[model samples]
Target chain A: MLPEPAVAAGKATRGWIDPRVRLAAALVYSGATAVWQKPESIAAALGFALGLAVFFRLAPGPVLRRLFAVNGLLALLWLILPFSLPGETLLQLGPLAASREGLLLALRITLKSNALLLALLALVAPLPFPSAGHALHRLGVPGKFVQLLLLTWRYLALLEQEFGRLRRAAALRGFRPRTDLHTYRTFAWLLGMLLVRAVDRAERVRRAMLCRGFQGVFFSLQEFRLNGRSLGFAAAVAAAVAACAVLEFGG
Target chain B: MHISEGVLSGPVLLAGAALAAAGTGVGLKKLAPDQIARTAMLAGAFFVASLVHVPLGPTSVHLLLNGLVGLLLGWPAFPAILVGLILQAVFFQFGGLTALGVNTLIMALPAVIGYGLFSRFLKGPRAGALAAAFGCGFLAVLLGGVVAGLALTFSGEHFLNVALALILAHLPVMILEGGMTALCVGFLRRVQPGLLPGRPSVEVR
Candidate 1:
């Protein structure tokens, strides 16, 4: 079977702060990191993100997992950027040389990515996706988009389980994935079969909804109310963002 | 080819977001309430695509079946990919939140194009569904790679080099996906023809 769903973090996150606040902070922090160009600012953002991670009680395992997932590209950037950039050489590897500009660019990317990712892990990781969707809806994201996000999240695990069974059946039939036509053809059928099954499931879900007197909107029983702690969290995000801005401008 | 955050310049990011927003608007508008659940299911498929993988000689690569999704869902691929990327970003941390608009466009736009090009081919009497399926997958990967490469060029990376690298890296994937898409099409053609596009009566089951 597939790994557990990512939003599983949300289950432990209730009674913290309003998800909307966390979601807003995440957007702002990420946006701020994106605008950041200075190494100092980016470094500060990274530190802030790490601090938030610790504060949010995110375990090192999950954080490291997220880091490793994105590091391949970052590593590639490190390799190419140093040699590709034209500036005073910071270091040289055999015939290849790293320019000051390229090193900065590469470092900037690593810092920004880590900082933003950590921020997201801390802020959004704990928030159940449904609440996040409702938060988005309250924040004026299109109802359709919010609905779409929730639906996708709702079904990802189910579909994965279905596909897992298919894969198991294939493996039992002596299917080992390789660079061969048979493998490709088999995988194709597997995916196609998956779509067919999912389509059928979708119809059942629709009928079930209809039978329950379902309407176009998915109503939630949870109420969203922002309070002092949420306002405090917002202030904290603003300060961190302001710090990033300062680092960008002051440096 | 999910572009991470903080890579592109502000203008480029804005432009990509705008284009993606427009595309998603069209896709979302076309989605009916009855179809919302189906779209969600397809979105689930897209989300799992990267998780499901097979060996590719020296290394393994997961599937990026945006073309198949596009071919089936039409305009809905836009919103579907958008939501999928959002989940991947938050949960998986593959694409960044800031670069989400750009990432969505890179993957979904090609799906839209694939639908336009391959849908007719699948239904035509003369064209083999297999060829159409292969074309849809191969070309979709090619287009997604090229556009993503072009997007990187806005950040001052060389166009040809980036595009070439992206495409070349996925060359095996393209061929593999092409074969897979063809097989999927063949299977659907036989068993659940109603689920595919260009069918007048949508499958009840």
Candidate 2:
């Protein structure tokens, strides 16, 4: 696996807050309260979001960039929700009826989603993927699946490079995507070629693997150590989760 | 787009996790010892596929290539997808650990099915690649939306509306994915023709 910020941390310590851990924590936190009918749930969600924002150190930039990129378009639903959803109208502007309840609901959903995103990105951004996979495997994810992940993680980098080369080669050949129908056909043909190449590469890779040892299973070199920091991270997360649960229960 | 944990009910996520485990078992059972290296490499490819996001409309979606994986690897996709999704969540925060099962089923099943069905539709390696690549990507997203809709419905949220909105949003995404798949397949054919599943190749001189 390519050396990444997350991988470096994972190699240093086995029990690190990989992106998956953060994402899972965020998802569970949000999913639990997604369906709550009470306004208290929304308040709790807002609090959780605020807590995550603080703890995760989610800066305004990357968070906004990702949100703008992923959910910016979906935000259009805000307009639709207010007018179409059934509830008391907050405002009457010409033909549009803005429902107070629908607007509140939309606001809650947006806040919840954004919070989840912030928490996940903050938590997962530091760890490498393979280390995270190993963590999951240790947590009882099947070995076979873990193997697949390790392999995918390794091969994807090479393949992506191959893809970059192909794209460059095509561009040099004057293969523009939008010039005409023929260009489109050429583009199609390029994709067909990429698939065939990926498979061929797979065969060579298999052969290379056999020449090395002929045995199945790839081993990761990094060793995991559960030290004070890991326990601390885990404990902190548990406390946060418990706090949320308590808030939910109390409210 | 991947969902996080706590986004759904505990029972639902657990159920999905169980199903994912079963699916992983089946994938493992199907894989031969010799195929492990190839399987791993393909899984890596699948994992990286998502990192390259192609812009479509206001939102951007990356390639899944599960169909291509399924077409090339067959039942091995189960384990492969499991790996890819795990990595995505870990490396990219695309999904969550609890949401892994739902994410896997959402993307991988369609890959397995599309590769199975479309492999027969095309005549040659290029066609097979096109069919598998496009079908896998487009169908995977559609399946994902369906799953998302179902999850929302199960939660007593608005299923149909969400489904419609998601499915509609994904139409252009499908086209973009299809185009990329075709290109990837085409290049593969020129450089390494033997890689495509079920294709007999003349030895490259």
Candidate 3:
């Protein structure tokens, strides 16, 4: 799975951030953002993002490039929003009038999007999937929900792998569906087959869960210890948030 | 698609969270301990199901399978849906942490209602299954779009325009998802009727 590769990269590059620490950081970050206003809060977020980038050992060039590629179209949407939204025009471009208020609003949204994207990259991209799941579970996410998270994490790669195999098999068989009709028919058959297999697999998984005395909640053998360092980490996050709040209020 | 952070305000997100918690509490009270294992399995199934994304327009929309969950779990659909969305948000980052409750309620509430309505009204097992599945699927997507629109509106984005846009976008998706769910439920009913949710007395009968 790509998760394995990502995890390996994270371990080799960035030190393993205990799920607990990450969870604490995320909570603090969210709370701080919620409490504080814009500009100063935005600066705090950027500072956090920078810190996260360093701790996670992320290559900014690569991650930022990837982020831009995925979200580039969204930027275009902002470009149109200014012109399309009614109000006072600040700038005139040929036939279009860009409203000052609308442009500012679009800019605000764009910043929000970028911040969110950066936060996600800093958080999940570096954290191991299992660790992230465990962290969420520890944070009082319901067992059933955690299990779903675990299964999705476990199966997404497998599903992609399976799809790849099926695609290869089709290629080998020289099965080419030309028109939309033929394509839909092939897709339907594929869908039917996938369902059959999924059902069969689910039965086995259910049986396995039963055998393990799965008491609705999945039990993790690894327990998170809230040591001095963790507390220190939490304090640091809190301090940073406090400083951000002060700056926001002071400003 | 997943709504990002800060898109919805703190109040709206908190409200969704509170509602979701209430739903889960009710669901838990109704469910027996023996049902826990089944719920866990279904949660896993729901997670896996979404990964099988069928193409819709430019972006591919995955099956929510909320309808199937309702048909199988009935009132307990709340907890199952909650678990499913929690996993989706954490593992896949499909939605934001704050928005998890909103997403779950939007997707799961319909399934719970569908189960209540269809299970009582429908005659045969196959008919019940089809009705539940189709209804849930159709409504779940519609609700998802609606909720997204609502969130956008709350954020000071366009209300009617956004709502209309979402509804129009999801129209074709609803038909496709509804049809697939109906067929799946029909097949499941024929092959494994026991999988369908039923009271112990019904099994005895």
Candidate 2 residue-wise lDDT, B95-115, digit = tens: 645577877777767767766
lDDT winner: 1
Question: Each predicted complex: what DockQ?
Answer: 0.66, 0.36, 0.24
Q: What is the descending TM-score order?
A: 1, 3, 2
Ranking by DockQ: 1, 2, 3
Model 2 chain A: ten consecutive residues of lowest lDDT? A6-15
Candidate 2 similarity to native, TM-score: 0.75
Q: Model 1, range A1-251, lDDT digits (tens) per residue?
A: 33333433333443558877888889888876887788998999999998887777776776686688777768988888888878999897899888999888888888888898888777876676687899888877888778778877888889998888998999999998888878877887888788888889999998998999978876656688899988987898799889778878984
- RMSD in Å for all candidates: 2.6, 5.1, 4.3
Candidate with top TM-score is 1
Error of 1 at B13 (Å): 2.2
Residue A125 of model 2, lDDT score: 50
Please report, as a residue range, the 10-residue window in candidate 3 chain A with the lowest summed lDDT.
Answer: A1-10
Candidate 2 chain B, run of 10 with poorest lDDT: B196-205
Q: Which stretches in model 1 have alpha-carbon errors above 4 Å? A: A1-14, B158-160, B199-205
